[model samples]
Target: MGSQSARNIEVLNQNIAELNGDINVSFEFFPPTSEAMENTLWQSIDHLKKLKPKFVSVTYGANSGTRDRTHGVIKDIKERTGLIAAPHLTCIDASKDELKQIALDYWNSGIKHIVALRGDIPEGGDRPHMYAADLVELLKSQASFDVSVAAYPEVHPEAKTAQADLLALKAKMDAGADRAITQFFFDIESYLRFRDRCAAIGIDQEVVPGILPVSNYKTLVKFSKLCNVKVPNWMHKMYEGTDDDPTTRNLIGASIAMDMVKVLGEEGVKDFHFYTLNRSELSYAICHTLGIRP
Candidate 1:
């Protein structure tokens, strides 16, 4: 048998080789809420554009009130930055005609990609009503643009079971979604298991893993709970009592993200979608760790 040291060196060399190639990456950003926020978003976009992402997505607000602003930002990004702008379209608060009109507008404006979603209901609101109950139906109704749907590796908060969630994902792909982007998860095992389950079900579209570099542990914990993503106890211990140490927290966050991506990369993931959360530094640092120099 080969020595363990030799095998380890071989694996390390393989990872280095994989990093040398062009790895497709995309970023997700929310539409700015104010003038200053708008400035920061644009600056982040400008800085990250040099990395040549496959495309960048701008998120829509829960109620669709930011529709105009989202459109404006997507249009500006396409016109000004030479980046493919994929605006998120949701079915939580829009009628069929309104959704179709928005799709038509995007098509007319030279935008071709859309991240179709069943957006979360506004806080403490009644059941959401719209043309599509979920993203699959929405994708089926709007056939003009290339559509992407959400996938949940750790299972959606509202989903009763992982099987049910996977079935929902299959329905989206069956409805002609072009790709699936997952919600952020810390565990690579969860992602790998989800991918295997998808393959078993014969849903074969690209499912890009969403990466979120933890900037604020407290905020991440809150969001993770809301979204049903399990925050491992080990993760908490890693950042335990680092609340006041911003510098140490960020360094630990970056290292954790790098380790996560490296493990996923080893599992044959070539594409990644980062939830930038409107900040560029942590994501930028993670990219650097992956040997992605812009």
Candidate 2:
């Protein structure tokens, strides 16, 4: 039994090494609000660009509040950096004409890729207006851009059921979405199960797993609650009392991410999307662990 356990660990480690060598990665960033944050964001961007990511995405704020800034940042990145800039577009608090104009603007600006989403309601709102209805509707309307829609490995927060969510994803693919980026998940099993379910339903688009390097456990827990992502009890326990130990927390976070990626690689996933949260260390360390060099 001991020998078998040791062999299993060896196999897992071997898979991790191989994945680190061959995996392709992308990153997501949000438009900065303040001058200080803007500086920090640029610094993070500069650092991660050294890894030569497949592309870098800038997220739009809820209700299109930061639409202008998002576009500006994306344009600047395309002009100044070597990374492919993909700005997120959402179907919330915007009319069809507005959404179309945004898509057209991106296309005209040489931004070919878009991460389309049904953004959450803004704060203090009783209910969202569903302006664009959902992502599939937006995808169907926007014919020029290569669209990537969101997927929930554990199911979307407002979804009726997991099967319904998968069907919705299939609909989005049918509506001309090129790919799907899943919400961040802790366990590899969640993603694997979701992928299998997608396969069973004949949804063939590439579903890139979203990797979030934990910078703050408390913050992550709060965000997860808002997004309806389950944070495993074991995960909380792992970081239970490490609040004061930034170094150890970051090390555990990187290890957890590397192990998750290794498991996903075993399941035949070759691409990953890191939700950088405007920071670089944890994401950088995880990439380094995967053999991505600066």
Candidate 3:
């Protein structure tokens, strides 16, 4: 028994070492909705800061107050932690002038990177930036910001077809967007297929895979549905009996993320974007498993 355990540990160490630190990682954080959440958000930031991520982004919902919170958090991350903070800007319920001014403000505030998007319309809100391609064009006209647009491995929910979605991405790239961060996906083959399709169609840009650590099956299911992500049956089976066991749930979550990234690394993928929902333990475990150290 002791010999078998030792051999398993050695094999695990070998697999970890095979994934060198050639990877560039970034994180996405949502703006905190309340004071306590704000505290938790910053705590998670502090916990993960040592990883020296490529950049940290704050999500902006389609609302005025939430927009303000996004900007505030972006500046706070830059000032307090000295990390590269990218603010997500949406052309939702705002005029072209409003969006341009916001872009100017971000540029003036020493923000060089922006994630431009035509955000989801809020309940009863209008969508002024009808397409993310248009938002990318607008950002380029305003300033030479490093802009990233969102990509969907599974066709975007609103897309007419997969080919149409690829054309939209090409338009964004042509309009001077630098890269794309994908919506989180569980299936590795789905992303690889998307990559191949992008390459065949002449879309030249990095499509960083978005990784979501699933600490709670219920929350994961809800968000995945909102984003049009398919939850595989294997995942459902894995979380079957952990409804009340957070400790076990967290372990399973980390294990899933670890397996996903390891396979990605084998495929020569070196960039990762994590949708960290103001938590660090699962993300930390996965990153550490991939040989990413403080």
- lDDT by residue (tens digit), candidate 2, 1-294: 699988987897787787665788999999998999999899999999999998899998775558888999999999989579998877776777777787777887889888887677766766645432265566456656677788899988888998888887887887788789999999788889898999899988899999998868889999999788888989988998998998888888888898887778778888899999999888998888677897
Better lDDT candidate (2, 3):
3
Give the whole-model CA lDDT for all candidates, comma-separated: 0.84, 0.84, 0.88
Residue 198, model 1: Cα distance from true site in angstroms: 0.7
lDDT (Cα) of model 1: 0.84
Candidate 2 global lDDT = 0.84
- Model 3 Cα lDDT, one tens digit per residue, 114-147: 9988888666655444678888888889889999
Q: Of 2 and 3, which scores higher on TM-score?
A: 3
The residue pairs found clashing in candidate 1 are none
Q: RMSD of candidate 3 to the true fold? A: 3.0
Please state every model's RMSD to the true fold in angstroms. 2.7, 2.3, 3.0
Candidate 1, residues 62-176: lDDT per residue as tens digits?
Answer: 6656878889999999999999999988887887778878887888888988998878777787776752225546545665667878999999898889998899889788878
Candidate 3's displacement at residue 224, Å, is 1.9
